[model samples]
Target: MKKISILALMMVFGVVANADTLENVKKQGFMKCGVSTGLTGFAEMGADKKWTGLDVDTCRAVAAAVFGDINKVKIVPLTAKERFTALQSGEIDMLARNTTWTQSRDTSLGVNFAGVNYYDGQGFLVSKKSGIKGAKELDGASVCITAGTTTEMNLADYFKTNNMKYKPISYDTADQVQKGFEAGRCDLITSDASQLYSLRTKMKDPSAYFVLPEIISKEPLGPVVRQGDDVWFNIVKWSLNALVTAEEFGVTQKNVDSLAKSSKNPEIRRLLGVEGKMGENLKLDAKWAYNIIKQIGNYGESFERNVGKGSLLKIGRGVNALWSKGGILYSPPFR
Candidate 1:
C-alpha cells in the first residue's frame, strides 16, 4: 500500500512537470502580449480598439496557435522603458514590441529574443530644407533621440568617431523625441530607419523630411519572452519560425487550406499541420500552424500589410526579403 501511494505521487509530479506552455495558455484563455505604445505601422490600437501592426500580428499568431482564435489575446501597450519590466513582472506573457535584440538584453535582461522578425538599421531623419544630405552633414547639429535604447549609444559612438560635436536632446519616449524634433528643439531625429519612415509619414509636412543615406547600426528587432521557461520560449520562437517557413514554402494565407489538403511537398504539408507530429511536439493541437497561417498569414504578408507596399509607411523590403531572394530573412528547418 505504501509503495503504491509513492508511485501515484511520483506519477502526478511527472505529469505536472511535463505540462508545457500550450496547456498553460489554454487554461488561462488569453495570451498576454506586450506591444509598443503607438509606433503607427509597428504596433498601434485601431479605432475599433483592435490591435494591429507587425508586432500585434505576431501576438495574434501566437494566440491563433494556442486557441485557434487570434482574438484570444490581451494587448498591454508598453513604452520603451516599461517593456522589459512588464515582461519581468509577468504582466505580459510575451513581448512582440519593436524591441532590438542585443547581447546585453539577451544576457542581462532575463529575456530571450526568439528570432529577428524585422531587419532594421539605425539612421537619421532630417528636414530636407536643412540641406543635410547625409549623417556626416550633422556635425555640430543638435539631435533628438530616445533614451534607454541602443540608439543612444550608437549615436554617441558614430558622432565621436567622426570627430563631430552635437547636443543630444534625449527624451524618455519616441513620441517626445518626435515632438522635440518637430518643435525645432533638435536639428535631427535619430532612430531605426524604418521607425524614421513611419514617423515621417505621420508628420504634417512629410515631404519636408528626408531619411539620411547612412545606416549606422544593425537593429534585428523581434519578439521576446522571459528566459528560463524553455517551453514558453520554444513556443514563441517556433511560432515566428513557422511564419518564416510558411513564406519560404510558398504558403500564403489564401492557399494554406488547399495546400494542406493537396500539396505534394512534404515540408509544406508538415508546416500546414497536415502531416507529421509537429504540433504535438510543440504541445499544441495538430491545427496549430494551420490556424496561424489561416488567421495571421505569413511573415511577408504581415510585413506587407503593416509596413511594406500596402501601408502608408511604404518602406521597401530591402534586407527583410527572403534569403533565396538575396535578403537575410531565413528560418531554421521546421523538421
Candidate 2:
C-alpha cells in the first residue's frame, strides 16, 4: 500500500485542528466572561444579585450568539490589574469590562480588542462645594485615581502638559477611589468620564459632585479576548457588530422577532440569519443574531437602559451615537 501524504492526513483532521474557544465554551455549558468589580451601568450586581449593565449585556450578547441563551454565562468580576491576566491565563473566555484600547495593551498584552463599545474621555469628578468648575483649576491639588488603568498616565499627561503640579493618590479599585475622595484623601477623583458619572451616582450625595467640562484624553472602551484565535475573535467581534447593525437598521428587541420573520431588507435579513450563511460562517445557529436582539437588545437599547438617558447615569450618546445620527458609532457591513 502507498504511504499517505502528510497534507492528506492534515486535511482529514482539519476540523480538530480548527477547534477553538467556542468549542471549549460550548463544552463548559456556558461562557466565562470577565467584567469590572462593580461599576454601575457597566457591570454591577443589582439588589437582586444579578449582573446587569452595558458590559454585562455585551457578554450576554456573545452568549446568545454562541449558546442562543442569554443566561448561559458565568460573570467573573475582575479589577483592572487582574483583567488581562484572567484572559491571558484562560481564566475567562472573554472580557467586556469597559477596558480602553491603547497601543501598549493592544500590542504588548496577548489580547485583541473586539471593538469600541463606548467612546469616552478622562475627566475630573469634584464636589460642587469646591466651586472648581473645570479640570484646570485643580493644578496643585492631589488627585485620587484607580491603579492599573490608563487613567493614571492620562492624569499625569494632562497635569504636566498644562504645566501643573499635583500629588497622586492611587487605589486598587474604583470603590476605594470613591471612598478616598469622600474621605478627603484627595481634592478630586479622575477617571474616564463615564466611570466618573458612575462613581458620582454611588456618592453619598450624587447631586453634590459633577464631572468636569474638560475631557483630557480619548478613551475608546470595548471588549477584549485572547489573541491567536481568529474564530473566537470573529465571533466576539460580530456579536457586537450585530447589535450596532440592528440599531442602524432600526431593529430592536421589541421588533426583532417580527423583522426576522418578515423583513424584506437584505441586510436585515442577513443580520437576523433569515438569509445568507451569516451564522454558518460563525459556526452558530441561524438565529444567533435574533437571540441577541430578542434577549439582550441592540446597542442603543443597552446604552440607554444602562448608562444613557433611560438610566441614572444619564450619559449622552456624544461620540457613542450611531454614525448616521451624527456620532461615530458605526458597524461594518454584515455581508
Candidate 3:
C-alpha cells in the first residue's frame, strides 16, 4: 500500500511538472501552429512548401519569441470546423488562423483568444457585370458562403432584417466557395472583406469583381490556444503585444538591435528585454521581443508584407491601423 501511494504521488508530480507549455515546447524544439488549410494572403503554402501570410507570420513570430528562430515552427493546416478541435485536442500548440473571436468560442470552446490581431468585417463580392451596387441590393440573390463561419449567421440576420429571401450555397472551404461562385452557380460570394480581396485576386478576371460597400459584422480575428494554460496564454498575448508596441515605438526589425543597445525610453527598453524582468516572468530569455522584432518585425511590418499595401492583396489598413493613427490597433504597455 505504501509503495503504491508513493508511486501515485510521483506520477502526479510528474504530470504537474510537465504541464507548463513553455517547458513542453522547449523539449519539443518546435511549436505547432494551426493555420487555415489554404487562405491565400493569410495562410497558404508556397511553391517551396514554405508557409507565408499574415496568419503565418503570427505563428512565426511566436516561434521566434520562443526558440529565437522563426523557422522552428510546424504549420498544421486546418479547416474552419477543425481549427478549434485541433487546438483543444492538443494537436496544435496554437492557432493563428483568421478565426473570429465570438462569445461562444471564447467561453464554451475550451480555448483562449489572445487578442484581436485583425479587425475585419463580412462583406459581399460580386462580379462587376452583375450590376449589384451594394450588399443591400442582394435581396434575392443566391449567395455562396462558407459553412461554420460567422458569415453564414450574418448572412441570415442581414437577409431576415431586410425581408429579403435568398438561398445559401454553403461549402466547408473557401476554395469551394470560390469555385462555385466562379462557375456562376451562385450570384454572390460573401466572406470577410480581406478574404474577398484575396479570392478576387485569384479570379480569372480580377478586375471584373468588386466588393460591396456595406460592412456587415465585426470580425475580430486572432490567435487561439487551449484553455487551462495561463502561462501559454500570457506568452502568446504579450508576444503579439510586443510587436504592436514595437511598431508604436519605431522599432523595426532592421533597427531593433540598435535600439536595444541605446534606446533611452523605458518602455522601449522593457519591450526589447533590455531593462525589465518581463521575459523571465514569462520564462523566456531577456531578448524575446528583440528576437521577435529582429526576426518577425512589428505588426505593421508583418501586415504590409503579408496583406497590406505592399502585397498583391493591396489591402489598406483601415481599422487595422494604430490607435494613435485613428484605428483600434492598440496594445497595453510593456511594463
Model 2 C-alpha RMSD to native: 6.8
Model 1 stretches with alpha carbons more than 4 Å out:
1-23
- Residue-wise lDDT of candidate 1 within 183-299, one digit each (tens)? 999999999988898888778899999888899999999999876678778888888999999999989999998898899998888887778998988888888888999998999
Best by lDDT: 2
Model 2 compared with the native: what TM-score? 0.94
Please tell me which model should have the higher lDDT, number 2 or number 3. Answer: 2
Per-residue alpha-carbon lDDT of candidate 2 for residues 86-188, written as tens digits (9 for 90 to 100): 7876779999998999999999776899998899899998899999987778889999998899999998888889999999999988899999999999999
Error in Å for residue 276 of model 3:
0.9
Where does candidate 1 have its weakest 10-residue lDDT segment? Answer: 10-19
Which regions of candidate 3 fall more than 4 Å away from where they truly are?
1-19
Tell me the deviation in Å of residue 198 in model 1: 0.6
lDDT of 3 by residue, 94-178 (tens): 9998999999889977688999889999999999899989777887899999888888999999999989999999898888899
Q: Sort all candidates by lDDT, best to worst.
A: 2, 3, 1
